[model samples]
Target: MWTIGLGFVAVLVIYFTYWLNKWSNPRCNGVLPPGSMGLPLIGETLQLIVPSYSLDLHPFIKKRAQRYGPIFRTSVAGRPIVISVDPEFNHYIVKQEGKLVELWYMDSFSSLFSMEGESRTTALGVIHKYVRSIILDHFGTEPLKEKLLPQIEVFVSKTLETWSTQSSVEVKHAASIMVFDFSTKSIMFSYDAEKSPMKLSEKLINVAGGFMSFPLNIPGFAYHKSLKDQKEALTMLRKIVKEKMNSPGKHEDMLDQAINNMNKEKFLSEDFLIRWVFGISFATFEAISTALSLALKLIADNPAVLQELTAERKAILKARKNRNSILTWEEYKSMTFTLQVINEVFRIANVSPGLLPKALKDVKFKGYTIPSGWTIMIANSVLQLNSNTYKDPLAFNPWRWKDLDPSVLSKNFMPFGGGIRQCAGAEYTKTFMAIFVHVLVTKYRWTRLKGGNIARSPLLGFTDGLHIRITKKSS
Candidate 1:
């Protein structure tokens, strides 16, 4: 009994010493940033996730930012994170990617979207460049001018025509379907109302929702479900890719382009190709859908904004004498006010909450030390919502963007992010939005139904399906 008691005492003492060392203030020059790490194992994971799950980076961040300045420490997604809201510092971090910091996501994210040998981490330098080049070539402005915009116009026209018949429609849900259809069709030439595209989108979305979930394999848990669905989605995509490769059919889509462009010697395998296809499709679909839904809802609530948007669209329609004329790239660039409204939507939505970059080594900034291996979250939401940057940051003011210099705006307004890994499909997203807005405002008027709110759930979107009633516009 005495021997056992001594052993237990020694274990407790060792653990106490370790805990003290782990949480202790630095022995080096700079101090750790101010904030709590919450409970031992869980840390502030719950505190971070609750508001995030509700689609707001509130109380946890806002409250802490108030108490601990722009930089603070918290634990989330099963790792210790340094949340930096300092705009300049955040910009510096992104600019210095691959040197000072490496992009990191939760384990579940890494697992679910694992691209074999060609992941963001594994596929660095030439491999990343190759994949990005392929994506850009397929989805870039030139491609949009040649192939995509006409299809988008058709999709939007058909969707609005359907919406006009219904007494009321859930705009977000409908918009999600529309974007998914466009994305799947563009990527894989697979889209149907009751078939593959719909199923694939739902499964991929479920996988995305569980990207930050705990890596537990319990049957009912989100992570388990994500892995399960991911395998299923992968199986479906692999079969499609195999069939496409085998078929000599000359399809003028992204899949065909990728297969033709692929060089196996460069280590770009069928596995990498399929992963890239589905990953890009799923990501762009959600982003476009979320942004469109929110933009429409915002325009509906703000009559003045809607009126201005309508005027902009009407002018374009008048210029093209035929009502059914396709939107031109020149016209997309000409909708300055419409672009401002979309920018404001991006700002307020903070659609992409924070850009994650892990510190490669111990780094000091703004009189604080961030330890090596710590995850640095460049909180874009904080910058967007900061009172210092905008006159009335919370207010949905599109007009503020009218006279702002492009250079000045780019520094602060990074909805698509900045640096080497900046969103490749930004132009694609912009074109989609411009065309959708032009078509909808010209053809139909919409009013938001009661009791719907935008929720974050880690992904910015409407909670109760942005319900709206639509009616055809009188010519």
Candidate 2:
């Protein structure tokens, strides 16, 4: 009986594999791009992601691009996708967002972030406009100057003051904690009631890490555990929402802002509010923290760059009246070298690796056909690393941008993305990082120690925490 059962399972596997391969490709007039769709159900997924786990430059795609040209076909996460490394085509696809394509996310991503249909990617038409407007009002330029900068300066200064006493700190963990605390305060007007701030931050980090996992619900799988964590996180947020509604007189945070403006006639529920807050918080939380960690690591690795960045920060500080004065928006904007360093780190880190959008209809581009419902992966990381765009793509050189024209950089550089679906929190994330960097470079210096590695399990970040030692600089 056991032998028969095993044989039957094997037969079923073979049948499914055969069916998936035939279904993935159908004869077309314009022809699809050249590449192999490895195996049937799996379809090159493992081959593509395994090398990327250590944050390597997508060996699977790069090797094929060398053989098959820039635009190629492959399957990932059980869906057939056209991976475009062509810079011009990518820019076109992203800019033509609503007309030619619509934003798409993986099942694991939507589930892990607890943003089923609430995120800008999933929301469409009036819903998308409304969500984007609210987010901008909360974290846009005006709010960053008036509200966020002062708060971030205080929190970052207080946090780093304690760090200077420690012998060595895990930079990634430390950064994650700081960003999460600040974000929670901005969103909910307080920290966690159920868990410690650090603990909650770590939980959110895990959830974010698993957002692009392979959507398996089996026990012991990372995605499964992340789903469980997502539920717990939402539950905590819901409790906070209830408490705020019950006892709040006047609060000045995203939570209050949202509550005050919610449509009572439409009867938007607490669940809706919780999802909105969670959507913004979860997406930006890890990216901002990872950006800081990577920035620290990169600057530490490059001494000349560090010296330049420190000098810039010092000039900004000297313009202030006193040591205790908070950095003004003008001061932050004036740090040109510091801005270059940040942009360089963004390019090297490739934090937002790729943008996934689904073909709204059978779209044709460059004599190639993308079927309706197929996934279009704008490989932004790949495009950034293209030899045609940057001088030496892999090198961490901030000076490359020194003489480069801003118009040219804007055309090729897409750290946030392009078009209508671009990240709403891009400027907000940058402001948070700028504030953190201004405080650190002005008051202290850090050295990245050994045993730090980049992790790309789902997205770009550090693994085992980028360890560093911090010390105060002499004035």
Candidate 3:
């Protein structure tokens, strides 16, 4: 009996050792970058998700980059992942979309979109380009100068007016709802809580951080609630799409653009169209709202930056013949400092920390090989937070961008991402944030009331909500 028990214990030890070796070793033809894969199935997932108190990049990426260098290997949630903080490599990877690599989202992130069936793999590349082209037609630079700019300005002004009247407001929650209301119009139709009973925005609020969370669909987890919230939002979105299809009028939003092209484009099927609209709406809302919220917190905390920002906005308004007149393309263009502020905010905010692209085949970079079926996280946030590039990397200093132009989308500072697959809404996001800061500084003043804590569950957000009491400036 003693001999049998000892033999069983020895077998268990051997099994554990064997599995540990497999997890640590990369299954590749060539050498792999150095980094720990952590425990077997879990594989550093908990460490990756563990929040860092600082506003800088997550400690998981930072410490690994420090110890293992810019490009490192690790397994995240049972998936082998190569994290690249090297700008040159990230640029190469993103540009290689459809060739050496392809667009990839984790199960948790992809589940939120609910775009299953044929749209999953082969058609993904084509669908991405198709949606990008149409969205550009409606929300691109030309559209901004002609129409969307004024629309955004009006919506922001009216929305802030409403906010100023309230006692205290959560910047993130209020901005999410307001931005959702505004962007959803361009995607489908107008969203008015009073006019429509659908709680799509509210559902989406729950969907925010859940996309980047671990792909656990079990109850009592954020991933589960996120998927549930996404389903609810999709149902309402589909209902709206069907109703729109029944109508003869052209709304001129993204849905109308898609519907008009259904015959011209085979990929714009009803299913894909619905999912695409949901995606665009979320992109526009999330990117702008998160940045806007973060910008306010930074500006509020840094009085000098706030003073300069206020001066820039005041100067823009002063140059106008009528202060009440709508902001012009030329005036928007002249907002050099304001644009710098936006860039700096994005750099610090790290709104979109992780950009995942999967390896299509064995690809060699430097001395290491990235095996096919592995995911590469362009940990741009890690790169952005590098002290070598930006002085006082963690501090909010828009003036640092004085010599460096923020307008040029480079590998070094891509809050909206970079390369061919860079966010199609890049221009739209910058425009929205620029105008948002302009309106914020010139028209109103705000005080932080409560809840300023922040975190990144792989998605950066105000953990307790950035609550602030905003009021209109006195005449």
Question: Could you say which candidate leads in TM-score?
Answer: 3
Local accuracy of candidate 2 as per-residue lDDT tens digits, 1-475? 9999999999999998778767567455568888777676677767755535444466776788788988888887678888888877887888767666777632222333232445434434444566677678778888888888888889899889989999889877777777877777767766662365436666777787567677677888888889888888888788778887776545477787667665431324576677776777777677777788888877777889878877887677677788577778888788788778888878877776688888766778888988777788887788667667788888889898888777777657778888777777888888888778888887897776765677664367655667778899886
Give the per-residue lDDT of model 3 (tens digit) for 111-178.
Answer: 43434455444455656677778878888899899998999999899988999899989888888888
- Which of the predicted structures, 1 or 3, would earn the higher lDDT when compared with the native? 3
Q: TM-score rank, highest first?
A: 3, 1, 2
lDDT agreement of model 2 with the native: 0.74
Q: Best-fitting candidate, measured by lDDT?
A: 3
Model 1 whole-model lDDT (C-alpha atoms):
0.75
Local distance difference test scores for all models: 0.75, 0.74, 0.80
lDDT, model 1, position 108: 19
Q: After best superposition, candidate 1 residue 414: deviation in angstroms?
A: 0.6
Could you give me the TM-score of model 2 versus the true structure? 0.86
What TM-score does prediction 3 earn? Answer: 0.90
> What clash pairs does model 2 have?
none
lDDT of 2 at 114: 38
Q: Which ranges in model 3 have alpha carbons more than 4 Å from their true place?
A: 1-17, 105-125, 190-193, 212-214, 246-251, 405-409
TM-score of 1: 0.87
Off by over 4 Å in 2: 1-20, 24-30, 52-56, 105-123, 190-199, 212-214, 242-251, 264-271, 455-458
**What lDDT score goes with residue 425 in model 3?**
82
